[model samples]
Target: MGVHLDLSLDADGHHTFQWRRSDEPGALQVAPDTLQRWTAEHEQFRAATARWQQVMAEVDEHLLGDRR
Candidate 1:
């Protein structure tokens, strides 16, 4: 079983935020109200994530490739 390390809700009353560790106990739960908020917050994070992902992808392909 995986660990339930973190949990958060969005403003739309959805349990959109979540994280699991290598070994955690118990089920994760969130209220509907939290879900709504999480979605809005997630949107902001998405932009940052995209930028980081792009740079990471390039680093993986070039700097950390087997050819290195």
Candidate 2:
């Protein structure tokens, strides 16, 4: 009744995405565009997280310095 999306990284570092459905015997491979979009989104998320972490670290340092 439902489909699930699965992601995997191969030994050579290639990413594979599969869509599995309860009614289907085999999983469907995702399209190249889907993979590319996912990759882009992941990179964007990582960059945003890194920037946020850097900002938080700077804020913490500033607060600690203010306390001293």
Report the number of the highest-TM-score candidate.
2
Q: Return the TM-score for candidate 1, rounded to 2 decimals.
A: 0.37
Q: lDDT tens digits, residues 37-67, model 1?
A: 6656778787887798899899889866778
Candidate 1: residue 40 Cα off by (Å): 3.8
Q: What TM-score does candidate 2 reach?
A: 0.61
Error of 2 at 66 (Å): 0.4
State the lDDT of candidate 2 residue by residue for 1-68, as single tens digits. Answer: 34457789866586755554544545445565775676688788769967998999999999999999
Overall local distance difference test of candidate 1 = 0.62
Clashing residue pairs in all predictions, respectively, total: 18, 0
What RMSD, rounded to one decimal, does every model reach? Answer: 11.4, 9.3
lDDT of 2 at 20: 46
Error of 2 at 10 (Å): 20
Off by over 4 Å in 2: 1-28
